[model samples]
Target: MSATTYALGAFILLAYTLEAITGFGSIVIALSLGALLLPIDQLLPVLVPLNICMTGFLVSRHWRLIDRRLLLGMILPGMAIGTLAGYLLLPYLDEVSLKRGFGVLILWFAGRELWRLQRKAPAREHTPNWVMRLATTAAGICHGLFASGGPLLVFALATTTLDKARLRATLVSVWFSLNSLLTLAFLLDGRLVPALPQVLLYAPLLLVGVWLGERLHRRIDERHFRIAIYALLLITGTLLLVGP
Candidate 1:
């Protein structure tokens, strides 16, 4: 393989490890690093398959932890509709709009977390119906647009009853399912399959990355873990919005 491919493969494998272990979604890790070496067009297709495979692995490994109710209540309806809309409209949205939207989403999420930490927001409450309704819908809208909407949903999930590890698992699992569905839809529309050769070629690196991410997750505290994620989101959002 070429040096670029090898490097990206290693990068993806490391990202996967973090997602696999901590239950954090891999979209940002994949999107940010993959951007350095691969086109966003190519990266999206590659990540769909990786997410599906990783989800399958996690479902088997942590099936017991999966939150079926939340999956159905918040994710399934909101995400499915949003993805369908994205699939239909993604081709038309200008890059400029996408970047601006991404910036808004990132700043909103990051700023909220920082505010929460400073205010020492009291013991978190269950996701109210209205909050879930709004957050899930917004998350769906963003995910459909960019395939990088984890921070929105992550904010919602982080404030809930589940502990850090379980929260991660649930979010990642939902992401896996959503990506799998989106991939099949993309295949039907013929937007991505022609590139499957690269996907097949890079499979090993994907798996290795998941392994590493999982290991790294175990070593860090959850609060710190989340801060790192928010920091990355901030950087990604700004670059996408303001970069030439």
Candidate 2:
């Protein structure tokens, strides 16, 4: 295989593994890194299906841990609005500026996370409803527009009182619903079929990565789990900011 193909394989492997371990981030990791090898127009179609499968697997596997209250009350409304608006606005949106703005948002959140880590402050026992609404709304818009919405939602979830398991499970549930919608949207628009062959080609490596990530997930402590998340946000955000 060519070097670019090899890099693509490697990126998918790592990205899927991270998603399996962390609950929500395959697209964020893949798109941020894969953009180096292929244009977003091509990379997004391939990654979207893969993201749904990954999140679906995790959600099913961890179904009992999901916070149904949060999912129904706080996330769905914003997601519904954002998805519709995003689908309608996709053709007219200024993608380059939007991506840079996305990067700035992520970096700002990452900075806040780092500050919290430095101060050793405890996670908040109660994240306000207004904050949850805003985060879910922004995540929905990003999900609808860019398919890279996990970090913003993750940032919001990380602040709550949920333990690592609940947090990961809940995030997976969100992705499952959002990505399912995205996958269907892509299907109706005829973006899914042409991408399937490439997605299948990478399936073996992706499964292997998921298996490895599951192993790592069991070993991660709470502190290290948050650290892993922050690391991903920092890397993905910087890449989005600097990439074309």
Candidate that scores best on lDDT: 2
In model 2, state the lDDT of residue 177.
85
C-alpha-based local distance difference test score of model 1: 0.71
lDDT per residue, candidate 1, 72-185, as tens digits?
A: 877668777766776667788765565566567667776687667667787666777778767776777677776766776776666567765677667777788788887887
Across 79-164, the per-residue lDDT of candidate 2 in tens digits comes to: 76776777677777566766676677667766787778879977676678888788778877877777877867876666666777
Off by over 4 Å in 1: 1-7, 36-39, 114-124
Give residue 96's error in model 1 in angstroms: 3.1
Using TM-score as the measure, the top candidate is 2
Tell me the lDDT of model 1 at 65.
76
The window of 10 residues in a row where model 1 has the poorest summed lDDT is: 32-41
